[model samples]
Target: AVLTKGVTPINFKPEFADADAAEGEDTDPHAFQSVANAKIYVKNIADAFCTADAEGCDTYKANAAVYTEKLDALEGDVRTAIQSVPQEKRVVITSHDAFGYFEKAYGLTFLAPEGVSTESEPSAADVAKLVSQVKQDKAAAVFVENIVNARLIEQIASETGVKVGGTLYSDALSQPDGPASSYIDLMHNNIAQIKGAILGS
Candidate 1:
């Protein structure tokens, strides 16, 4: 019953100990957003489920540990890849505002035509304003998100005379066989794309 945006669904029914309690179901549903969040979710789920389903507690804990290790390794790879980019050219523009966690984690500066949420299209004025900002900022590249329409970014690139950088995966994971199915792969692909564009520019 727990739900999270951009996370694969947990494919099981959760049973609470206090079934008849008046309060709503308690869960930290968006648990896969970060390693820390995943850790918390595993702890909470284990405590709750261990009481109800003792036989499966150890298995769940083991799986969580394996996944956590992978996440940690992915974080390291992201750090190294982003660090490979020159510090002076670290800023870039994208079509949507979906990179706050990435910016915080990977030391990237992301400018977007839209605001923090991609719930609506950017107004014409908004696009023009961002174009001006990109030129003023001397952004290294103009990138489009895989999930967003690229026309605005193309327009911005044309206006600024900067090349279309590359497609970045945002919000949703790519297909399992693609370059960005996992968070680590997404970060690596993005950094490589950005670095290539900026260095080539």
Candidate 2:
């Protein structure tokens, strides 16, 4: 409808669907994983909106550009913080798998007992295997995600004698007043936590 109407409409995640419901539907979308991805989303939204609504095209483009600049700055800060950790000590274990983008962007190695998504838990045997790997690798730290229960990570920490590094913002953004309200803030908070844990800050 946007293309035909020449006006952009906002899309909200299913998690945010309640907010949409207050307005009306339930949805559980989890597309935005990082600030970089958010920036791309913003650009795409703006372009689509502009193409649909010529009257507000300039405004959309300008706002996207401004927001994208902030995302770039946030990326720089994350890079700087992650770089503070020694490359050899950059390996980290998390309770669930959600750091592929983070690992690719920053120079960290991630190990997870759970598969790529956090929807399911790993088996006891799988956890035991990962525990052994953690010990063999001497991973700098083990982390839990805000969205996942920490019991599994705690057990792994106990078995491996590695302290729980800190919470990593995985599937969702924190509340607006929290440390990870935005995608950039999320990455910055995560990198800072990882560095502090691994580097003894």
Candidate 3:
């Protein structure tokens, strides 16, 4: 229920956790959950404003239109960059299962030894399984997220014989001076890191 494809959002209190749980409700726990998958966010905001003031709503819609265009252009650039790499060299490893949306949108493969959150420590078996997967799939390189410890990824790279790709911004944006300080910059930086590591150009 993380995403409902533009459905109205559900509001609940933390104290009502049990009330939010629905048994037998089929869901993809690992489904893509990112700003990319929430493309309706701006539209929803605009629509909410329309309920208050129609005139002001037009302004929101206009702003959303500009943002949508920027997002489209960003996707195009990322797609082109990924396409430049050979299919066999396109695979990547990250710290966690965060790029499901990007992978589905852009058609690149991403393997992770951890789950969505960095707070949870990955088991040794999980690391071994990911290492085996990296070797079998011939993953291009492993990249550490800015928010996670880099040791695990370095270990994976050491064992898999793949180079450490680079750092990627995951949960939050970096400081203004950092490479991935903005949304568009984050996309460009990630693509540059992956392409540089895989294609070495």
C-alpha lDDT (0 to 100) for residue 31 of candidate 2: 34
| Candidate 1 worst ten-residue window by lDDT | 11-20
Candidate order by TM-score, decreasing, is 2, 3, 1
> By TM-score, how accurate is candidate 1?
0.67
Please give the range of 10 consecutive residues that has the lowest summed lDDT in model 2. 1-10
Show the colliding residue pairs in model 3.
none
Tens digits of lDDT, candidate 3, 1-201: 123455433222222223223322222232212345445665666677777788788788898889878877876788889899998887887765456566666777776553323344557776687688788878998898787788778777887778788887756778999998987788788889989988866
Model 2: pairs clashing at backbone N, Cα or C within 3 Å? 6-52, 6-53, 7-52, 14-27, 14-28
Over 54-164, each residue of candidate 2 has an lDDT whose tens digit, in order, gives 999999999999988998888788878877888889888875446655665567887764322234465778678768878887798989889777777777788887767
Cα lDDT computed for each candidate against the true fold: 0.64, 0.70, 0.68
For the record, the alpha-carbon RMSD of candidate 1 to the native fold, in angstroms, is 9.9
**Candidates' TM-scores?**
0.67, 0.74, 0.73
Per-candidate Cα RMSD to the true structure, in Å, reads 9.9, 8.0, 6.9
Q: State the displacement of the C-alpha of residue 107, model 1, in Å, after optimal TM-score superposition.
A: 1.4
